[model samples]
Target chain A: MSNKKVTGKVWKFGSDINTDLVIPNFAIYMTREEQPAHCFVANRPGWVDEVQPGDILIAGTNFGVGSGRPIGDVFVDLGVFAVVAESFNGLGLRNCVNAGLASLPCKGILDAFDEGDIAEVDWGTGEVRNLTKGTTLTGQALPPEIQSIVEEGGVMAKLKKEGFVS
Target chain B: MGMNAIEKILAKRSGQTVVKPGDVVMVDVDTAVSFDYGKPNIKKIHNPDMLVLLHDHVVPSPTLSAANGAKSLREFVAKFGIKNYFPVGRHGISHVLVAEEGLALPGNILVNGDSHTCSSGALNCLARGMGPSEMTYIICKGKTWYIVGPTTKIVLEGTLSEGVFPRDVIHYIAGQHGDFAGRNLEWYGPGLEAIGMDGRLTMATISAELSVEFSLFPYDKVLADYLDGRAKKPFEPSFPDDDAVYDQVITINLSEIEPQVVLPNKVAWNSKPISEVVGKHVDQAFIGSCANGRLSDFAIAAQVVKGKKVAEGTRFIITPGSQEVMRQAVKAGYVETLLEAGAVVTNSTCGACYGGHMGLLADGEVCITASTRNFKGRMGSAEAEIYMGSPATVAASAIAGVIADPRVALKVKELA
Candidate 1:
């Protein structure tokens, strides 16, 4: 939890970028490592090849709205620094948190930065700043108890640490 | 302050005197269901008796991964001492299987890895779909947290007209109002009694298309009669207090509704009545999925295609949701009627509906389906068009080689 801020180039996406689009049903049968290579292939064929490890994603409303596929696993695998959406599907939010990924819901995020713009997000301070636009917005952060689970590296990791799970 | 059904259940399970919206509580789960699709890697289960496992996504193992997933469940069963395991040939979609086995009790909390798990809310439970990691936690800890949201009271009235089905009703709702993200919906009205268990379950399942976390129907005599001898365990019912508060109220008259057809690829902004999309040619007609794969759907489909032949080139594919449904359907002679009409009825698996196998659409093909989803690339080719309708509509469309109205094909109206 020491590094509360994530600064990286923004990779923008629109609303309802569902799990099916992230890692398709066919791609899902492949190993987790290979799944990311097909990420967003339907919309952006070969887009996974261009996503740098430390890049961030800013998306519109209802991001990751469909099936309960672990889209966060794909993001984490692609080395996405952080994800900020205007709003998230309830299941999508939980999946990201359980995968130990930082997911923030910041309203008016689209106006703050265009695709490939640099943005700095401080989860501890609930601030999302677009360095390119010189604008700042507030993002909804996870509650303290939930944040601790992320800090502990997700649900299973914490459960393992506490001997609640093997 | 009065609390709604979800609040009451959350408060009661969380050991709180009362709960309001936005209150995050760790509530106990009555049943934790998982399918073969994304089976969790849980080292231990909190209680073996509370877990329900099934091999449903691709039964009979279409691929190496699906085969391995089903195989892993056997090890999961022995290791966890879980007795409620449904393997290939014995399984159905978890959502349908859970209801048939009487595992979905009233006044309980059910969690599953599949998004359509909310379909069980028809039985008056606080059921919602969770992710694999969250499901893994629920399996290990016997509980999961919920950030309760305000409820929307949907009042139903009048009688459902002939040819109109629950699938259409759900499409109509979404076509009218967009998404219901982060909210719960409670259904109650004079029309409730007539919808029946199968109808209610269909509506509840398709409601997930709107991203509505929970689409709940009250525990009435209809539900009680359905569960009379079928319930897996003893149960209680929870009805909202008379003075319960709601964020909004939306009333729908069942009689005024017509058969709705959701255009290929989406529901929220893309559902229209049958008249709007009539005469559209189809290459395939599908009737199955957790949404409408019950015995009632088969009965309706059979009635629509009785003494008729399938369209010359149209492929009519029907997959029952589960083995039990198939058994009842066969016993009822619905399968014979459908098969005689040139319909290719397959085993009880999520195969074709999930684009896994059995009946995948080819490029440039158009299919009228009575299944869960019709999104782009959902039923095989990304270029294939999938129009969703009621089973009767799909059956009629298959017989005509184009999307047609069931009302015109049926000699008599029969309710299942």
Candidate 2:
């Protein structure tokens, strides 16, 4: 796995942040490129316009708790570098990993930072530091195989490089 | 240590004699199912023998993009000569079709592109949902990696009371225990005798809403009868040993459960008694989805709305889980009863549940559905409210134009 560090401003949210809130249902029919424009349209209008590439999302428990609708693509398309939450939905976490985004589950991470606070994440070591608050916390490190998949830019890219897929 | 059913299934698939939680293993998949939405990511087919393609999410094409996607998927299926392909009208939801057609068998490991793939666990299969990319990889490699999860033993005792259905049992579990997260739920006890295969499927399907990766039941005579002649091949059934170790055990007294309702915007941890939600106006009532679209659900709904008329202001819709379920409902006369009550019965599809097509909700509208999720904008408008309940409650509420208890409604109808 690569030892790249992800540093970005944080966008904090509450518990049960569902997939529909990330990318609304109306955006499902749109192409992946078109979808990033409509991200969080209903829950937080203008979120797509405000979020810059490499921003981080921090949330309470049960984040991305809804249908496995590939909303993670919006994050990937928007160039989100990392996601920190108390816990994540099983399928949602899988999608995030598949989309080549780093997702960390750090208990009480939401309490450590406010919206717009700067945060730095070391995915290789699971070290999370809230630069603005001058505090640090450890997130769960990714499994070896999963880390390899992420380092290779997702499962598809890894498989393709190995000549497993045409 | 003795292994649970999931561990056993994973071990067998991985060619290992013993496996434990957190052990990463590459498992040979017995079956893999994909839909139109996953087609774009699939670049090539490596193993057609183990794959099944379905067009169910947006049947008949809800938009131009969906139509084009369906067309491309059809071409891909034809080019690859995929033997098991179900086009629109030939199948229902992928989960329902997989279970009903016996594509997923006992002791087998199955994966699908939809989260509700956990529904196949009702047949004693270790099933879970994977992302499109992972599913595509499975199609090419016929195998995928999994970190074995600790099993959670959920033992149900006593018999369900009147008006309490399998849906209520699961709702109670979600309300009490919260989501299972990444664990596999092993359902057992004398309660299985009363739940049957249909009820077990509903329980397993909704486990996804509980964030459970897999919800499995042990093989029994009921499952054997249901799979007779429908299985892909004869296979030995697997079960957890009596001394099997579980990460945790949750005992639920089914008799204590009431008709439950999961209020708007959350599937778990937001349930309440039907009495508390009664009289809340509902503009729509839907009875379908992989969770509750089987023939039994239709029968229960028909039994409640047999001679009653649907409320004028409310629109009631019924979509069967599969073509076979639709035909059985017709032969059983449940369709006529539902139609007689002014309910619009449509073809089998996952459209309305995902807001892909059919019966979309308007702003400020309230809907009571038998589907799995109740997340915001799950049906349509973000402002709309969705209450998840059993088919009986949905039917009863359809007639009252509000959230009503099926037991009370049946009593009032009998008196009238």
Candidate 3:
């Protein structure tokens, strides 16, 4: 796994933030490069204009709960560094990992950070440090296999490197 | 050590004598399904014979972008020499068509790019969804690794009350137990005898709503009958050992279940009795999706709306799950009854279920749908509220312009 630390501005959301809120089906037909512009447009208009590269998203329990649309492609295209949630939907978690977006599941992390707070996440050590608040929280680390896939920049790249794909 | 159905399927495919939860093993895929959205990402095929390409998400090309995507999928199918491709007009919702076409069989390990792929698990297959990248890998390698999940045994007893369908039973399960997130559920008991293949498919289709990794029914006479002439291959039925250990066991008495509805925003958390939500105004009523868009759903809706007209202000839409289902409904006169009642009967697609096309709700509208989910902005506007129910309830609500009880409507029909 990568030992590098990731620091970004936090975008906090409430519980049960589903995939439709992240990327609705209307925008699903757009090419990967063009779809990021419509991310979170339904709930938070002008979100794409405000969000910068390497930003971190944090949410309450049952985050990304909905159809297994590849919403993670938008995250990857927009250069989202990682997602931190109290819990996650199983299919959404898999999509995020496959897209090379790090997903950290931490209990009570929503209570510790607010919107726009700068946070630093260390994947190898499982530490989520709220740099703005001067506090830190320990999150559950991904399994070694999953972490390695993310570190290698998604399953496609890993498979290609291993000669599984052309 | 005893093994469950999933374990047996995985072991057989991987050529292993035994398998258990958390064991990572690479197994051969019996069937791999891809839709319009997923087909664009697949670069190569490790086994052309194992892939099934379906065009149903944006059937008839709702927009220019969707048409372009469909074109890309068609090109991919041609380039790969894939023989199992189903174009628009010939295809329906991937989940429904896969089963109808006999792509998934008992004891097979099936994977699709859509979360609703779990619907095929009702036939006693180990079916589940994988992400796009993982799907690509599977297509390239014809094999993928899985960390077997601990199985939960859910036993259903007694029989469902009239007008109370399998959708109600699933809603009750989700209402009582928050979400089966991260768990694999195995269903069995006398209730299986009561709920046949169609009802079991309804139950398995919503497994994604509860975040279940996989939902499976045991191999029984119902499944055998459903697969009689449809199966691509003749296979032996697989079952869990008599002493197989389960992580958890949940038993529900089906006789106690009433017609149910899940309120807006959260599909699983909020569940109220049908009486409580009845008479609530609804602007739209939909009866289709991979979950409940079959011949049975249409028959129930047609029965409810036989002699009645759709409410003045409501837009009622009916979409069959597949072209085959559509033809069957037409042959049975259900299509004519639905059309005569002022309902818009559209082609087989996942229309309006994901707000993709065919009946999007405007701002502040309220809709009662027989589809799977009701998350914010799922059907249309985020400000709009959505209620989930059975097709019978939706049809009744369409005629009354409010959430009405299906039993009352059926009673009125019988009296008339």
Candidate 4:
């Protein structure tokens, strides 16, 4: 597997980072690149400019518990590198995986990473390497089926690749 | 190793040799649902032979524009060959109509676009909620892959104490189980039949908040008798054999279960002694929804509203949940009874369960309702607190102008 690591600034948050905060529906009609600018607009007003292409989002437990509309579309629109959290609400995890957005559940994420620190995220090996801290945190290895979906891009692409449709 | 009831049932349906906790297998869907809002999605698929569309939530009360909207939905139903379309002025809530129509058979697997799809598990089906996207996938593809989960058998025995309705039983279980109890909740034992269909639906409907996979009541004579006079149809009958497996079987004796209430913010916040909120006056009292808006539910409500007017400051709304239920309620004079009691009987639509439409509460107001989910902003503003209880409790609370224990208010007779 290619070690195509994603290096960018880091953003942090606590538990219950609902989809409403991540990708509000009002901005859904816009393209993905335009969405990151509005991501966390409700909670952290200026998250868009602070985050670079490969920046990582770290959150606490019970993340993604609200309505399931906004997360998938917004994350895809914004091109977030990866989402690392203590745990995820079932629907949020499902939506993220289906959308081909990388997510890792690692314990003590709050104490491990800080804001604007470049981090390397590798999907193949399921590892998040903190370059500044000189520390590495491993996460639950993605199941082969899910990994395949991510490699194919997202559920729609995976469906096409599987010949589900033309 | 043996699998639990949930695992065994799913394994059997999916044609799997064995089902472990994490085994993912595609299972056949027993019931599929669509509604008025889903009409747009249904038009895209253009397949009506495989869907149940009901317009119980948004009937567009009296205005001509709203009437036109309802008519447009009906025209769509006609364009598609959907055999099960409950148009406004015809059907109640989807969950209630599913039961009344004899659609939710025992041991069947049901899938609906709505989150409260688990309500049909009252008929012993393995029901799970899905969103429009997932449902669209299911419509295009007939089956869904699911991870087999262990079953948690919640066996409640002994007679229910006075005024302890089925909603109380479920709320109590949710309180004890906490959130994420979505593993499985199966109700068994002699007491199962005593709860009847409406009560069983109430017990199953609220399982959504608990993250329960599904709730089941084993098929018995009560259910069979209810089905006898109704139109007959072919159904697959299933149950756990004597040697069938189960992860854990917990027995709850009902004699000790007094009137229970779920406090604000979470349906699982089960509290003891309803008397604690005796003086907490409510601004609104809603006694309907997919949770507890059946004919039997209203009969219980009418018992409390027969002669007394609603609390002067309270707005009591009663929704029967289905067209047939409304007819039955009207025929039985319960509707009149509620009207005399100063209650506004609204159409059989889903209102107040969410802030979406109808019966919205103002800021800082409190409501004692029979609907599910008391989460902040669920019914209205986050500032408005909601307490969930049985229909009997909601009715009694409406009469007393505050949260009340129906057992004390009605002096309900002891269970047989």
DockQ values for all predictions? Answer: 0.57, 0.58, 0.55, 0.20
Worst ten in a row by lDDT for model 3 chain B: B36-45
| lDDT (Cα, tens digit) per residue for candidate 3, span B1-416 | 89988788888999999998877667998889998753555555788888999888788887787787888888888888889899887889988998899888888888998788899989888888887778887888888766677888999999988789999999998888877666789999998797877789999999888878789898888898899999988776679998787999999999999899999988767887798889999999999999988999999999999988999999999999999999999999999999999999999988799888778888999999999889778888878899999999999999999999999999887788
Tell me the tens digit of each residue's lDDT in model 2 across B1-416.
Answer: 79998888888999999999888888899898988753644556667878888888777786787788898888878767888898877878888998888888889988998889999999998888887778877887888877777789999899998788999889888888777676789988887787888899999999998888789998988999999989977777789977898999998888888999999988768899888889999999999999999999999999899898999899999999988899999999999999999999998888788786789999999999999888888899989999998999999999999999998977776778
Top-DockQ candidate index? 2
The regions of model 2 sitting more than 4 angstroms off are: A162-166, B37-43, B413-416
Across residues B76-192, which tens digit of lDDT does each residue of candidate 1 receive? 887778889887778998899999999999999999998888899999988888887788888889988887878999998998887888888888998898677778999998888
Question: What's the true lDDT of residue B195 in model 4?
Answer: 77
Best by TM-score: 2
Which residue pairs clash within candidate 1? none
On a 0 to 100 scale, what is the lDDT of residue B138 in model 4? 64
lDDT (0-100) at residue B127 of candidate 4? 78
Question: How many residue pairs clash in all the candidates, one count each?
Answer: 0, 0, 0, 8
* TM-score sort, best first: 2, 1, 3, 4
Order of models, best DockQ first: 2, 1, 3, 4
Q: What is the lDDT of residue A95 in candidate 1?
A: 84
Candidate 2 residue pairs in clash (backbone atoms < 3 Å): none
lDDT of each: 0.85, 0.86, 0.86, 0.71
| Cα TM-score of candidate 1 | 0.95
RMSD of 4: 4.6
